[model samples]
Target chain A: MRIAAARERKHDERRVAIVPDTVGRLSRLGVEVVLEHGAGAAAGFSDAAYAEQGATLTDLAALAPDLLLAIGPPPGEVLDTVRPGGLVVGLLGLATDDAILEAVAKRGLGAIALELLPRTSRAQSMDVLSSQASLAGYKAVLVGANLLGRIMPLQMTAAGTLTPAQVLVLGAGVAGLQAIATARRLGARVEAFDVRRAAREEVESLGARFLEVPLDAAEGEGGYAAAQSEEYLERQRALLAERVAEADLVVTTAQIPFRQAPRLVSGAMVEAMRPGAVVVDLAADTGGNVEGSRPGEIVETNGVRIVGASNLAAELPTHASQTFARNLANLVELMVTDGELHLDDELVRATLVVDGGEIRWSRPA
Target chain B: MRIAAARERKHDERRVAIVPDTVGRLSRLGVEVVLEHGAGAAAGFSDAAYAEQGATLTDLAALAPDLLLAIGPPPGEVLDTVRPGGLVVGLLGLATDDAILEAVAKRGLGAIALELLPRTSRAQSMDVLSSQASLAGYKAVLVGANLLGRIMPLQMTAAGTLTPAQVLVLGAGVAGLQAIATARRLGARVEAFDVRRAAREEVESLGARFLEVPLDAAEGEGGYAAAQSEEYLERQRALLAERVAEADLVVTTAQIPFRQAPRLVSGAMVEAMRPGAVVVDLAADTGGNVEGSRPGEIVETNGVRIVGASNLAAELPTHASQTFARNLANLVELMVTDGELHLDDELVRATLVVDGGEIRWSRPA
Candidate 1:
């Protein structure tokens, strides 16, 4: 079977779904690889590199293969090129968009989204979001550290002694934990808080003190935080306010999937911080946890600085791309064999969203 | 000897240098404690709590204590009340504030900063910065996860499958590493990059891929990235741009003590990323490693978000305050005896910045 990897239609998405290294790996597995011209350029792989890796260079029309791989869902034009019963795989943010799924079903095409893999131990190697969020977490701390007005570690010298800075992290998820570890390494004091009880041990294990607030834990299946009651949120806010006032830096990361981020830090809390204090809101895209936070903007309140950043992983590209490639490679290796596709893997079956002109798996009706 | 615990001078600070539990511990150590009324109120302790813990509530001027424990350096008024040869210990960020040290020296007082403890294994309990930074790192990742426009892990449904989000972490230091681990736990694909080669194993051990860039491995004495030549910076930037273009989120945590953060992400590099991408900068207060990144502001370049957060630890305040209190208590316990004072511990020697009108044990020149 032949597969075609094409350019992403989404604006600013320079990364091709398949890279030259993966092409070599695919070739070793006996799968025929085809590429649209310069598909990997944005990620630093040239068409020549794809050729060197044994992938055939062909025009889009001539390279119409059984499967299509893209960084995002296939655009209308690309979707029209797929053969009946063929598969298209990539990031299909289907919850927000239904047209793509309709298009796949209309075309009698099989589509799998890499983002929907379950958080199970057996699916660890196939997990892509964990790989990417890890990078975003590490990068956020470096950004915060760069903007801090004072140094992190204390020093004693004839000139005078310098005190270490204080840092507070709101969410104890992947990105928040990484920020704690990075800030600690830089010699800053760190503290973290999370609603999920399971997160407490992880936070403390990283050597960060976990702030336990009196709030009802509402975690859904798979350990995701479910939406909470207003009363619970208010109590959580009151408990957190005293701590917020004492921090020199605060990073808020609490968010629920497909929902607006819960408002955690209030206006009074921001007002209570020092003049030069800074707050980084990671939930700005979904309505921030901090009051007066605007997505992609900085709001200064009572001399305290509030930053609402939308996406944090793009700041470090080289590593991000390499990790993306590795994860994709691992997934590809699991689905291909003897230079052909193995469509029967349980992993593939689990992720297949649409096939044979119908929606195949279970989801919100 | 008589000792007084004064109120913190900083308007936003609420944590007292000595908490009620510690006051009880100090009382058992033969240390006479005089506390300013309402000193521990901000940290959720009442005057009655201090009283119950065996602390004497007294006016600052009338106390004339031989030792003073303060959350911050003593206010000018409190300092003026101290007798010659009195000791003052607290969270004085002396490295950045020379005036406080001068005040201690001029008054012929002994001053010790709790943040100056070494990072050896034996000193882990006394490592106040590590305790706080660990929390900061954990919280930073949570912030990023919440801000991200999509879910971290992939999910499968009959409607369609969701793709995993990609996360990039800049700097493999403590915070960055923790960010990597936290993001991984949340099911994001994580990649970490650091200038220090020593961090590779640590990053990898956490199950995150380490980005290896070709560069001179010139780590400083403390295993930090040393100041590099302009040529090296340029090379680092070029290499980083390739990876940044592919990430959904990027967290930057690289910084040098008392120096501007190394410029890592440029405007051109940011322009290459997908729209809705987020960047959380941990170095905004000093200067940002990302060009066009404003401290405490989210600068949107071609739809890419740059977040420069200053105080990440403050976001997780309850735990941060508790850990900081414990550190302060431990440091004081090392020098106080049965509600009294001792001036002869090696730990005290290392932390004491000024004593008897001179810079005692100051690092050579």
Candidate 2:
């Protein structure tokens, strides 16, 4: 079987699904790896590096492989090239994009969407979302620290003692946990909040204080914080506002899959912050968790600087691509058995969006 | 006696010589504390904060205090406000600018330049250069880490192990030591170089390797790494070129007092570095240690970023101002005893630029 990887067509997307290091791993899976000439260029992977690993370099249209891999969901034109029963795999955005799933079904293409992979110990190695979110969380703190007008670390000089900056991270998930860790590393006094009780332990384990609110853990499907009731969200807003006002830096990573991110920080909270305070909103791409956050823009409101960072993982393309490519390689290795598609596997069954000329997986509305 | 600090007039200079925190200290020196309105505004000290500290705010030109305190040497018009026989104190740049000293002599003013303070244990608390340089060094690392296109820390993820970034710091002064410490804290593998042999122990104590250059320590006047011979500098450059090419980040902090900074990282050396490598030139304001560095601009040469970071301490205005204010206060307290200028003290004699209508201290030619 021929497995081909294509360059992501999205303008801001710099990550490639298959890296040069992963090329050798896929070759051992009893398949020929074909890549578009400049597939991994943006991620600092040269075409020569890919060729060094014995991967064939060619045009995606000319290769017409039996199996295809991508970072984003391939457009309609890309879907047209796949023969009947050919396999297509990527993040795919199958969580909410019904049109892409419908197109795959109509074209009789067997598509596997990594976003649907189960959040289990066995599937952790192939969890692309967790890997990318971890990087986004780390980058958020760096972005905030760089924009801040004062030093993050405390210093006692001949002049005077400078206090460490106080950083408050909202939503203690993969991204929030990483932000807390990075901030703490830079000698910041970090505080974090989460709807999940389990996140409190994780936050504290990284030497950060967990902002306690009088509410139960709103555990949702796949161990994520589920959407809270209106009353709970209101109470959360009130509790978080006080912490936000006291913080020198705030990093918001509250994201709900396929939905508008819950608003946690209000404009009043931002206004209460001292001048030179910085806020990095990681959920801005999916309709922010902070008031007045515009995606991909850094806005100064009153004295506070609010950065709406979208696709922050793309900014650290080298490592992001390496981690993402490994996740793709792991998923591909699981689904391909004896150089052919093995759809009966539980992991494969969970991710397969279309099979045998029909839509096989149900997407969340 | 009246002590006054005015708003700095130099472009891009945000630090104030005195802050609100030091107002009470200055009051203890048997002097009335008066401040120019908005003196500490850029450094985040509110006018109300200064008022609460028992400082009277008024126009600088109108106040005309007995002693004038400033960060930079004020212009002729600002100096004109001070009554002849009154004192003016600051980092007066006596090593190079004789015109300021000549003007003070011509005006019969008692002037003290902080840059000429003796390097001794008693004078350590009043070391403005050391305090400000320490902050500059710490900031250079932060600036480089933020601009780099990759992560500084190593990560062992399911994807693969990402290596820690390699950082090379040139010069081992207070700023260089601080840069090494900050980079080490961020989990980068740090290496530092210096002409002073005493720096090796300090560098190694911070968990960074000291790049061993085969040469005798060229100790300069006043306990600094003095200017080196042309042949010695050529040999030093040859030894550093390979390390410069190998490092992901190079922070150049080599500077000589009142002279152009030594060019350590040649343009050829910058070209040898890999694409996306960053060089933070801390000496850029006094003529760069790295080739192609412009004082206040970030230059990209052959895919390597060379940041000409002059007055980086000013960028961290809050702490920089606090530290500078304390240094100024210490100098003022030492010089003014019982409401009179005590020129007999060694510290006072060393720093005094003009006394009794004559240039008391001759500058280095």
Candidate 3:
């Protein structure tokens, strides 16, 4: 089996699909690794380092491999270069991106979209969403603390005593839980909210208070919160405003994947916050969970700083790339049995979007 | 008794001598407070906030009071506005800045320089240096962590395990000790070094290892480490290089008041550090302890980031201003007994730089 690593095409996307260490891991599995020149440069991995791990490097024009590993869906022009029936693996988001699925079907490519990986104990090792969300959540707290006018920890100095900053994390997913943990590590008093009652234990385990809204459970598919009724969302927003007003920092990570992110924080809630309070909206790229969040920008709305941070995982590229590459390797390892590609595994069946010259949509359970 | 505050005149100097909360503290002492209209604006305390605390707001040109409280020495023209024989208090470096001392002497202004406060148990409450350095130390860790390409804490994910970052702090003084504590709180393995043997206990108490260098003790007057000989400094540099090379983040905060800060980390040492290593020099304003550091700037040399972070305390203006104001208020409280200025206490005598028509130079022991 042969695999090629492709450079990420998105602007400011520094994460590479594989690191030098992962290149070495794949080579040990009887796989021939190929890379386009400078593929891992942005992630602090050099071509020479890849060569030391028994990988071959070549220009895109000279690149033709049996399998292509990417961070996102490969650009259309690059997909044209892949041999017909060759495999393409990445966070293809085929369920949401119709155009990518159409092109993959036209090219007769075998596409494996990691985002469709089932949330099961067996598939946990190949979960890219959880790995990347962990990094984003940690980075969000750092951004919020840096922009804050007050220090995070309480200090009792010779002059006086300063109270610790109060932090609130909205949503109790992987990202929100990580934010709560990071904020607690910095000595901030943290609180978290979630529509799912199951998230309450996770929030409390991280030394944070779980905010209760007294609403019906809105648990969604795949262990995520499903879309809520309009009335529930309105009441949830009203209850959250009182907590938001008392917080010195709020990190919003309420994302619904393919749909627009639910608005959890309102404009009036921001106005009620103390001057110099900071809000980091991680869902800004998919329409923010905060009322006034602008994607990829920091804006001040009535003395509250709203930082719409998109692609926060890219900010910590070294570790993010390292963790993500392992996830990719685990999925590829399942597909190749005894140095031959085998798609009979149920995991492969669930993730395959394009195979055998047709778009194969398998709804993930 | 009446006191007025002058707005800071230095570029990027945002901290005010007083905050609204402290205005009420002074009011109870029967002191009528006057202010320059926008003195507290940069620190997030509005003019109306001060007025609500019974402070009278007025333009700087019309400021005439019995006492002037300031962060830095007021410009000569502004000093001339004060009534003759009136008192002035702040972090006025009278031991240095001969020009300012001369003007104070010529103008017959009663000046109490906080920089000269004795390092006694009783004097600790009025210790402005210790109070401000605590904020600077906390911020240095935050700035270093934010700029580094890796996360500070050890993370265990489904993909793999990441080791914690290694941190080194030089000069285990108030600032250095706080930096070590802050970095440890963020899950970094920290090490510290100080010429004073007494610092070893403080460093170890904070859950950080104390680096041992075989050398003679160089303890100095007023609880500060004395200057070392040329040969001693050279030998110390060689010993520190090995440790510096191993650290992911190094924060240097060694300084002698009114003297050029000691050169602790050499340029060769920084070059030997791994790529993406960060070195934050908190002594940059008084001649940085790191060779390549420039005041108020962040630069990269040989792939090592050197942040010349002078005035780091001012960056967190809200808490910085609050703590600093309380320190000033404590010193002022000792001067006024029964609604009259009483300079009989030795604490005031030691802090007073210029009294009557003569410059009273009291060398703090």
Please name the candidate that would achieve the greatest lDDT relative to the true structure: 3
Task: Please give each candidate's TM-score.
Answer: 0.50, 0.87, 0.90
Best model number under TM-score? 3
Candidate 2 residue A69 Cα shift, in angstroms, is: 3.4
Q: Which ten residues in a row have the lowest lDDT in candidate 2 chain B?
A: B218-227
* lDDT for each residue of candidate 1 in A1-365, tens digit (9 for 90 to 100): 77778766666565566766577766676668898886665555667878987899876767676778766688878888777788888767664565788888888888887777776766676566666666566555655654454445553322124467788898887678877776676567788888777788988887778876543344436222323656556666676887889887888878776567988888888988865578888878778888999976778775577888655654444344455555666777777776566768777887788877688755455
Q: What is the lDDT of candidate 2?
A: 0.84
Please report the candidate that would top DockQ against the real structure: 3
Q: Could you tell me the lDDT of residue A112 within candidate 1? A: 84
The residue-by-residue lDDT of candidate 2 on B62-109, one tens digit each, is: 868789898888877778878767888888866446688877777778
- Tell me the deviation in Å of residue B154 in model 2: 2.3
Model 2 segments beyond 4 Å from truth? A6-9, A56-68, A73-88, A93-111, A213-239, A337-344, A354-363, B59-63, B76-86, B93-111, B213-239, B337-344, B354-363
Model 3 lDDT tens row, B158-222:
88887899999999999999899999999999999998878999999999999875454444352
Worst 10 residues of 2 chain A by lDDT: A218-227
Docking tier of model 3: it is medium
Question: Which parts of model 3 are misplaced by more than 4 Å?
Answer: A57-63, A76-84, A93-99, A102-108, A214-236, A356-358, A361-365, B76-81, B93-99, B102-108, B213-239, B356-365
Residue B5 in candidate 3 has what lDDT?
A: 91
Cα distance off (Å), candidate 1, residue B323: 27
Q: Candidate 2 lDDT, tens digit per residue, A37-123? A: 888877778788899998999876865777888888888777776666798888887544667778878887888888888888888
Q: What DockQ, on C-alphas, does every prediction get?
A: 0.03, 0.52, 0.65
Docking class of 1: incorrect
